[model samples]
Target: MPDLNWQKSSFSQQASSCLYLAAAPDGTVKLRESDNPDVILTTAPATLGALIRGIKAGEFDHIRTA
Candidate 1:
């Protein structure tokens, strides 16, 4: 994958491990974290939108790990 015009969230601090998103030419969404830039995750726009909606609805709030 070539260098993309990744954009960080406005709520993120200047030097924090922020989430970055970019739209690929192929219409897919690219996601990566500032702490681990090499590991990129690609997904469809609709699926990403659903995930965001779920997040906003607090659907994943109950998730916990031991």
Candidate 2:
């Protein structure tokens, strides 16, 4: 993978802690934390789109952290 242009989400906090996204050359998407760019997660564009839609639909609202 070549250099990626990362963009922070609008919902991200003003603090340094945030997530960034970039579109891969092959049309896939990449995700990583702004504070830790070394660790990255890549996924298909369709999958990422579905996840965003699900989030908008509240599909993950039931998730709880201990």
Candidate 3:
């Protein structure tokens, strides 16, 4: 984490509430919100790709609207 280059979430325009992402040398993707950098979520690239595809396909809409 200390050596990782954290990047802001493209979906958020404001830096204050933005999310940060990084990739470890081991190839694991990491995510954390700028507001709470202490917490991190790690996942593989393939798994993250699938989740993004699902989101674009509206597979998770019910979780918010229901």
Candidate 4:
């Protein structure tokens, strides 16, 4: 994964227990939490975009609220 330039969220401060992302040459995106880098979530850009949109719309807020 050396070529995978992992990037963290800008919102992450000094204690960066945030999500990290990396893109592969094949166009697949990988996501992982800084606290557990070993576990990765692989998905397409479209799916990721939907997730981001849902997040922005607070559609998944029920998960946290529940």
Candidate with maximal TM-score: 1
Q: How close is candidate 4 to the true structure, as a TM-score?
A: 0.81
lDDT for position 16 in model 4: 44
lDDT tens readout by residue for model 1, 1-66: 677899998899864589999999899999998888888999999999999999999999896789
Output the better candidate (1/2) by lDDT: 1
Q: What's model 4's overall lDDT?
A: 0.87
The stretch of ten residues in a row with the least summed lDDT in candidate 4 is 57-66
Per-residue lDDT of 1-66 in model 2, one digit per residue for the tens? 798998987888764799899998898899998778899999998999999999999998896879
* Residue 37 accuracy (lDDT) in model 4: 84
TM-score of 3: 0.81
Candidate 3 lDDT for residue 13: 88
What's the CA error at residue 16 for candidate 2, in Å?
1.8
TM-score of 2: 0.80
Per-model TM values vs. the true structure: 0.87, 0.80, 0.81, 0.81
